[model samples]
Target: MRGALNNLLHGVRLICAVIALLAFGMSVAAAQVRFDKQPLTIETGAGARHQLTVELAVDPQQREQGLMYRKQMPTDHGMLFDFDEARPVSMWMRNTLIPLDMLFLDDKGVVTHLHEGAVPLSEAIISSGGPVRYVLELNGGAIKTLGIKPGDRVVSRQIGSAG
Candidate 1:
């Protein structure tokens, strides 16, 4: 009887351990959030236009999980963050697996600041330089390759009147 009881207890412990591991795995998967995609265009000062499909990170939870653990992003695809109103914004590349170029835009959707070639997995703060209502993150070197610069306008329905 004693041996049977011990075996039963061991089996219960093993079941609990498996359950705990399953729960932890589920939570980790849930933490990787995905956002809705939208179409956006960048009209440069020199009469060049670039089109991209971007994921919208509009809420705090979506914004916080921006591009973390993403192994790759296509050149014509990116992420767009909307702050709801113009304010000073800052970002970092912690846990981000790929380099990016950040475009800071004001309320009018005009590019006000550009941070190009942000290092992957770095904790360095990338500031907007001034108050900005929106931020667009693209693959590294995209700014130069696309001829995007300050004064470029981002056109998207998500920006309301500025689109």
Candidate 2:
């Protein structure tokens, strides 16, 4: 009976070990960026609108922490800040490590202003130029490289109803 109990204990230990390893593996698999993805488009008006995959920042906390600690981002990825109201907004690169092009847009999705190649970690104010409801941040110099400019329009579900 003593020998049988020893064998059963060993078997139970082995099973626990296996279960622990499986849990660790599952956690590793789940360690991915948690950004919510959405389809976005920018109508250049000059022709050839551009489509992108963007993460939306709807709340004040997300908007405040916007791209602060990120070291790198995919070229096609961006973050869209929606204020839900048409009002002047200002931005800065304070804790943001990666340079970005900030696109300020009105509720109608029209780009009201563009701040291209904004310096990383700079505290200087980047203004919206006018009342806006959305702000899109993309890799630095993307505005010039992608031919995006003021007068363009952004299309996304998070921008609220379009006119």
Candidate 3:
């Protein structure tokens, strides 16, 4: 009888532990997208360049609510939110902390609009005046440091394809 009671108690404890772990896992899974990093090269001008590794946000939800509530971004690190088709995009820095430079790019990766020195934590609409397929949010001043400007070419290899 004693051994049976011990076994029963152990089983209950095991079940409780499993439930706790599963709950924790689900919470973590809800917080972030499963992004695949892609290699990219940004050319600002002749002989001026930067190599980057950007997170590919290929889903609509990921692209719509990009970098919004984030507090910090590493240097040379940024998020590239992608849309299935080019459309006019408007973004706001609702809960974003670190100032950013929003680069709006067309399908061909030509920078069409640049909202530079974006003020963080503001609700004002920052829009890409024309249609855009990609929005790159980088640490403030990173574009200027790389000499990136409007009409400069931005190139990216697909997430899992060889280029």
Residue-pair clashes per candidate: 0, 0, 0
Q: Candidate 3, residue 85: CA error in Å?
A: 1.2
Could you give candidate 1's per-residue lDDT for residues 1-163 as a string of tens digits? 9999999999999999999999778558747676999899999999998999999999998898888878899989999999989999999998798999999999878999999999999999999998999999999999999999899999998876543
The residue-by-residue lDDT of candidate 2 on 1-163, one tens digit each, is: 9999999999999999999998777445434334577999988978867889998777776777778777899998899998888899999998688999999998888998999989999999999998998999999988988888788989988775534
TM-score of 2: 0.76
lDDT of 3 by residue, 1-163 (tens): 9999999999999999999998677556546656677777777756677888887777876665567656677787888877767899888887577899988988888888888888998889998999988888889998778888888777887522311
TM-score of each model, in listed order: 0.81, 0.76, 0.74
In model 1, the clashing pairs are none
Cα RMSD of all models vs. native, in order, equals 5.3, 9.9, 8.4
- Per-residue lDDT of 92 in model 2: 96
Largest lDDT belongs to which candidate? 1
List the global CA lDDT of all models. 0.92, 0.85, 0.79
Least accurate 10 contiguous residues by lDDT in model 3: 154-163
Where does model 3 exceed 4 Å of error? 1-30, 159-163
Worst 10 residues of 2 by lDDT: 26-35
